[model samples]
Target: MLKFFRSIRQRLFKQKKFKNYILYAIGEILLVMIGILLALQVNNWNEHRKSKGTLKSTLKTISSDLKRDTIRAGYLIEIIELNQENSKAVIDRKVTIENFTTYPRTRSLVTIYQPFDIQTKGYDILKRISEQQENEKDSLFADLTQFYSLFIPNIQKSNERLEKVVIGNLEEFQEFPWFVDWSQGNTTEEMIAYFAISEDYRKKVAAYNVLAYGNHLQLIKGYKENAKHVLERIEKRLEED
Candidate 1:
């Protein structure tokens, strides 16, 4: 194409048609500019396509992480509920000395401490990608930041507080003969007597377990909702692509 344009300009120049030559030169310049613009537009489109592909993969991984989080949260919530129920039975005198000797699982439940686990590795990847692509600043990124950075940390902190309360309550009666013997699969009459004698500690444990259960329930609800919103946003974006 360049050779054809050069040949035309040479012929026009040889003919001494200066005006026509100038017009031909201008047309050639315009064609070159148009070609360059087209090439650049194609490159931009390619880059945009690659970016969308990457975004889709990242979103899929994040969705997987969120699903795992929901499952984990649900499991932890069940454990908390069981612990809470056990504590309530003891606190409300529902489990008397007779039944306490029979049901060893109820006694075991009081001594268990299960902590909430947060999933963040997928979010970490998303954060890194968002940071590298400075132009990708939108509501999706904002929502992701809030969910992974703020919301998750808050839930973890609440879990930590719950742990401290439950552990502190346990420590108060850790040295008791009943506590030690009960831990060793010996729920004897003496252990029951000791448990009944420690009414104040039992109340504290029960109260803390209730508080932990409530906190966990709220956290799980928030996590599920946030995951749902994020999944919706990701699916919508993918569909638009």
Candidate 2:
């Protein structure tokens, strides 16, 4: 193509058609510029499409993560609420052996600890992207940042406070002479009697309520609601996209 244009330019120059040659040269340059602009536009369109696809996929993954978190949060909330009630009963001296069958939650409430379960795999990837692009101001990005960084961490912190109490007490429980039947999962008579009238047992159960269970239960409940709200926000953002 260059050769063909060169031949035409030579013919025009030899014939002394300066005016026509200048016009043709200008037209050729314009065509090249237009072609380059069109190619750049297409490349940009492809990049935009690829970016949108990645964003959609990541949001979906985060949505799934939120669902898993909410489900686990629901279960934990139930146990914690039971713990709250059981703790109260023990502190009030209402957990007698005869009534022990009715309030069997003391054993588990003191011995078992559930960690805060949250998934941040998708959020972590998206967060890095947001930071690299300086897109923290974007509403969706900000929402995600708050959910993962602030909300989730608070839940973890609260649960950890309670978990330390539950787990720390669990190891110490074995040292109790009355807890010999712990391995068998049987609520021994001595254990029931300790819970029934022991001031130390009441204090321990009160400490459980004050340290973590009482507040942690509410946090888990609120977290489940926030998780759902964030899930809704993600869906809305995806729809807008």
Candidate 3:
């Protein structure tokens, strides 16, 4: 094509058709510019498609992470229920050493507290993508930002509160008149009597269950619902193109 254009210019120059030559040159330049523009447009189209596919894949992975989180949240709520029931039995003087096995929820009193470990790797990847697309102001990204911003700290706070209460109760065992001979992991009769009847011990159990763990349970449930909503939004985005 360059050879052809050069031959045409030479012919025009030989014929002294300066005006025609200039017109032909301008047309050639215009054609080249058009070609460059078309090429750029096609390249941009391809890049946009690739970026879209990447976003879809990222969202899908995040949805999977959210699903896992929801299931975990549900499980944590169940654990909270069990622990709370156990605590209520103790608070109400319904459990004792002889009937400890009957209260199946008497599994965790001061040791095992629910600390939520939410998955964030997928969201981290999404955040990087969002940063790259700062100018775009994607509404989906905005929703994600809001969802994560609202929940992450709440989840962290819930876990921290639960830990504080449970661990604080464990530390008090040394001061308790019942746990003086706390050598074995086994619960002693004295400990059972104290937990069942002691007002101080009942208050401690109530604080552990009613204050922090209860709030933790509610937050987990809320997080699960929000996660489900985000997953639904992701599905809609994925379905479009």
Which lDDT tens digits does candidate 2 get at residues 1-241? 9999999999988999999999989998998999999999999999889877877898998999989989898888777776788788888787877787787676665666687767888898797677656665678878777767876777778767877787788778779886668657776678778767678778887877775565777777777888888899899988888
For model 1 the local lDDT of residue 150 reads 65
Ranking by lDDT: 2, 3, 1
Model 2 clash pairs are none
lDDT of 3 at 114: 67
How good is model 1 by TM-score?
0.78
TM-score of each: 0.78, 0.87, 0.87
List, residue by residue over 36-150, the lDDT tens digit for candidate 3: 9999999999989988887888888888889899988888888777777788788788876678668744535655676888898788988888877662468887888788888
Residue 231 in model 2: lDDT: 90
- Stretches of candidate 1 exceeding 4 Å from the true structure: 1-4, 7-11, 102-105, 108-111, 132-144, 166-174, 177-183, 188-190, 225-241
Clashing pairs in 1: none
Q: For model 3, name the residue pairs that clash.
A: none
Best by lDDT: 2
Poorest stretch of ten by lDDT in candidate 1: 102-111
Worst 10 residues of 3 by lDDT: 176-185
How large is the C-alpha RMSD of every model relative to the true structure?
3.4, 2.3, 2.6
lDDT value for model 3: 0.78
